[model samples]
Target chain A: MSNEITTRMGDGERVLFSAEEIREDIRVGTAQAAERAGIPALSAEEQEKLFDIIADPSRIVSVQPGEEVIVSDDGCSMSFYGGQDGGGVGAPLSRMQAVLTYERACGADTTSLGHSDYSFKPVKPIINFEANDYYNTSMVTTAPFFYGAQPNLGLYFQPDGPCPNAAELMPMGKIDAARQAQEEAAGHLTRDLVFVGSRLADVGLEGLNLDTSGSAGDADFLAALNAVARLKEKVPDLPILMGASGEFIIGMHGEVEYDGQRLAGLYPQDQVKVIETAGADIAGVAINTTTTESLPWNLSRSVTFMKAASEASNIPVHANVGMGVCGIPMMEQPPIDSVTRVSKALVQIGKADGL
Target chain B: MNKEIFESAADAILRGDPEKAAEVARKGLGEGIDPLTLISDGFVPGINKVGDMFECGQLFLPELVKAANAMQRATDIVNAAIPEGEGQTRGRIIIGTVEGDVHDIGKTIVVSLMKANGFEVMDLGRDVSTDRFVEAAEQFNADIIGTSALLTTTMEGQRRLEYKLKETGLKKRFKTMVGGAPITQRWAKRIGADAFAENASEAVKQAKALLET
Candidate 1:
């Protein structure tokens, strides 16, 4: 149904998300792979996993790593080192190395997950607090480095600055402070995203990154423009899925002046421009967390944030119900049903708007 | 007083005013109402509406996530009111997105589910290495350790985890479960994993099942 109706972007980028096209993609890329192994495709109730046995040209068994180690997640009872405060990098590193060692040890267990290329390249776990330049346009776009190794999935991306954990909602942008954080993180962190990618390859996971080191509001908008310009130059044909957090909306929520009764109804119009200019084909907005406190509360804050943002953004918007259904009690495990319910409710608005 | 406060609280949430919603919920509690009923009747329905709106594309991720935060405040109020020990829960679990793979969406979902279900959850967060998993388990005294690897390359890390546990002799200390976009029961067995659940729901089942083992 959706796959056949092809829509090309204004930039002539062919964006294909028709029902059939998407189905074929799922069938060929994910479903077929599962079928080949004689396994059923994962249900929404099932987690997504990727498995591969790479046959590469290069031999990797010979090279030693920046550090040789086994990695495992066995719960050794490590204390938090306050990561970047420089209070305890050593313990975290030691703990991290042991984990990597266990990941290596997984190899000693089976030949099926083995790769042709493997190396313990000298790289430290790059930790940064911030990425200062939301509008950083001059930096060269570096392609992810595999160097002969296939990567693992998942991207543990550190923001250019400290990622604000939101228990409450507040603040449209954190640029200057974020840049200061990046400054502190610039050199203290040992590796770049590329290094992270290569390390992921060493471990056997395909590396993925949701690059959102950009700040929110004006600087974020400028940052978006810069990133989009760079992406357009690098991969003009690429179809992008924009991931926006509800920073500004929450900021609006927490503005002491706004009445609690009506504040959620107000939306940040500027952010819509920022997202649209980012040149993404789709947008997924996540704005709250149980960790950070920009707002006074947690769960229901997402509704106003999502609604206002939806009314504002021109691109296809998808809401992220971060801790909603999972927040529901008696439900042992929140299914995709967490966001499904919210998305269902959000749709009624589209119907009302005749969209 | 019944639907009006709930609807208004929900409206406050949709308007992005969680403090107001919290205040409203607090007002209800002050009026001598049941906290459990407030949540079951008031909060859940509001969130359900938000969820529906999100599914319809009327709301975006940022909006929904924020509302989830707003709802968190409301939940905190409600949960605080619910007398302890009677809260519905299974047990504690340690979860991470695995080393190298940092897609936190699904992992976060699992963590939230654990918390909501009344299980103490120590989220090692994303791109967690094996040591941290072990350390978190030991520190949190977690009974179940769940690792997620969304990449094919990284699933091998999950595979390595089993052997690392055996080598360290920590295999018996905790029940190790692996899943992601690429993990399967065969891979789970090949790597000597105790269990593999398809998604978050299955993850809960597996986590619960392992505790009994």
Candidate 2:
């Protein structure tokens, strides 16, 4: 029998790829992604090293048995948000408690505290110029518990709220109206982020995660960039981690631009440069997982894009490594076999600072 | 003369200009063009091109959504002007995000595509219970029921929907489709769904196939 290497697809199907084929995939995938993103591709030596790591015979691979790297999470409230019922029935305090326990058990470099609403939009009305103080007080109450925790504590929110609101105008056959609304919404989101960010910073919040920054497309990405700029100005010391929703920004408004570069169709490498310009401390890069493709294909593509992103960024590049991104399966609890391999590849081959 | 209007109609959709697309439909109707012809020969071709571009990664979600909106605008005007009993939908579909999953973008795109493909779709919105799927399907006389679950935690709701339909003896009455980021054909099979679509365009194709059989 032939000694072909086997791996799982994004859909968990077992597949085999020979050593030669896997290396070719890495080289071709990395070059194509680099060319498309307008960034430097991985060298031949780097591609061969990545292939070796992926083609390891073991079911799971890691940097070493006990070694670790910097790790941070987006949407940290999700575990408690889903809870036992999976209906977001759990309390926010329980989420904080879980984080503290996780830190105590298995240390993380950073942890985020957030509400289930996750987006700045819902909290905007609740914070309402301090008139209604419910949500802010909850944040204040939870901020102190993480003061001495091993992991750095940060607040998290997505800039996804405005895109849907703007899309509402499109169904009415108002294209320009939708574009204008997105612009206006970006301004409002910037203000809300600064307000919330400053308040949380006062309560010893260490960092802020702008999770899933471009879910609503170009307009959504602009809001995150704008927020990051304003937050740095307002809370100069607060580190911001901006994680993208996908590899490429969708052109929802299709006309909005940032720093003279069109936000639409920007890949991770190009995306991180703007994040650094906006003064974010970490650029969280994500590549979409194609469920139909083999794990080798997805992993190679993810690493290729991520390596470009890492090379382009002056700030720390934290690859988003779970749930349909960065070669991880789109499952709730991603299989460790794939997760370890992806993490090892990204750090060893992609040069990512964290996951 | 007619060819010029058809090309403009298609171009308006390609540019994702909803107002212009609707204007073209109105202009065509005023010029004595058949409503069906404006849709089948004009706008449908434009949307089909959008789908192909999207599949090949040339277009993104924003363009896809806008094109769908443009197609909807043109189709709405043409469909309303169709001779009384000649406006027949290809099939009826009811769709929603399964319980505890608030993700709606994927399902919304599927709804837009289904409508663009001449399927009568009633969107049930997000966080819909399994019972609501069966109830809505029966009420709308739907030929297919589509559910989306973006989270791995919420995928169980799709299986629950399948079980609820089987228990209510309505399983065979309507084809069931499951789709989302975490959903796969294997999961669909395990959950007893009739089909699983990887994306919105595939959802339309699956719905058509489900209706045929």
Cα TM-score per model: 0.39, 0.78
How many clashes (backbone atoms < 3 Å, residues ≥3 apart in a chain or on different chains) does model 1 have? 137
Residue pairs with backbone atoms closer than 3 Å in model 2 (clashes): none
**Quality class of the docking in candidate 1, CAPRI style:** incorrect
Which residues of candidate 2, in runs, are more than 4 Å off? A13-47, A64-69, A73-105, A116-188, B1-12, B17-45, B52-66, B69-89
Off by over 4 Å in 1: A1-355, B5-16, B30-32, B48-65, B90-92, B102-121, B160-179, B184-213
lDDT of each: 0.42, 0.74
lDDT tens digits by residue: candidate 1, A17-67:
444443333234324223322324433221111000001112211112432
lDDT of 2: 0.74
TM-score of chain A of each: 0.33, 0.82
